[model samples]
Target: MTKSENTLIRLEAALERILAGEPKRIPKNRKLSIRAVEEEANLGNGSCHYYSEFSSKVRILKSKQRSSSSQQEADTGFTDFLKSKAANEKRIKEKYRSENVELKKTIQQLAAEHHLFNELIRRLKTQSKQLEVENKELNVALENTRDELTQLKRERIFKLNKK
Candidate 1:
């Protein structure tokens, strides 16, 4: 039987024994075993232990429900955060793809420009060699012309001295 039922039996037995001329004193220090119920007879200090214990149980249940609801909201938020992160990652990947295409084009253009610069350098070196050869030829021609002019001046001086 439950504790309350047992208490009821104990009280009844105590009362029966008193009626049988056995007036034994009930122990004042006997703490009554209570379940989840308000024992108003034991209502002291403006609160019942059983009532407070019941209220605390109720508060705990309510708090659990509140926590469960809040956790559901957090789960929704986490899903949204994951979705946003996926969208952002997709956007970044698209950006990188486009940038990679542009970079490839730039690399191709730079390679072409590099080839043109190498060709220009080769042509410049070829032209420089041709100029050097032409310079040497011009120097030899100038020496020949100076020698002929000197010979002509020498003949003129000899003829003039003869006159």
Candidate 2:
């Protein structure tokens, strides 16, 4: 046989082996594809694309496999499990998203409250300093008044003794 004929034959055998899940050159249970077939046949990449008829056949076989597998999954109730799992995941994602939004609002409120408290503390400190200055002034004035009273009392006592 010609080299082209030999290549076509190898390609056909590879395609069958892959579809039957009995690949020799490649690992078993690999997904069916032109590249997989090429590897299974020990042929170079893009070898199968040169033959349009083979490419079409591969497409038809892959579609059939997909349909059959999907039907089997439905029969085994696996499709239902996957659907429920996906729904649960979606619900959990939405719950977390809403919680994240609430947490952000709480953080914003706390930040505002923190700013208010800091401002109040600053005002209190200023008032305390003013009060301290006023207290010191009052103490100095009271000491001067006591000294004047003592001098007046001494002058009165001396005047009475001389009389």
Candidate 1 segments whose C-alpha is farther than 4 A from its true place: 1-54
User: Tens digit of lDDT per residue, candidate 1, span 82-135?
Assistant: 999999999999999999999999999999999999999999999999999999
The lowest-lDDT stretch of 10 consecutive residues in candidate 1 is 31-40
TM-score (C-alpha, index-matched) for candidate 1: 0.62
* Cα shift from native, residue 153, model 1 (Å): 1.8
Q: What TM value does model 2 have?
A: 0.49
Please give each candidate's TM-score.
Answer: 0.62, 0.49
Residue range 55-162, candidate 2, lDDT tens digits: 899888888888998899787797688889999999999999999999999999999999999999999999999999998998898888888888889999999999
Error (Å) of candidate 2 at residue 4 is 52
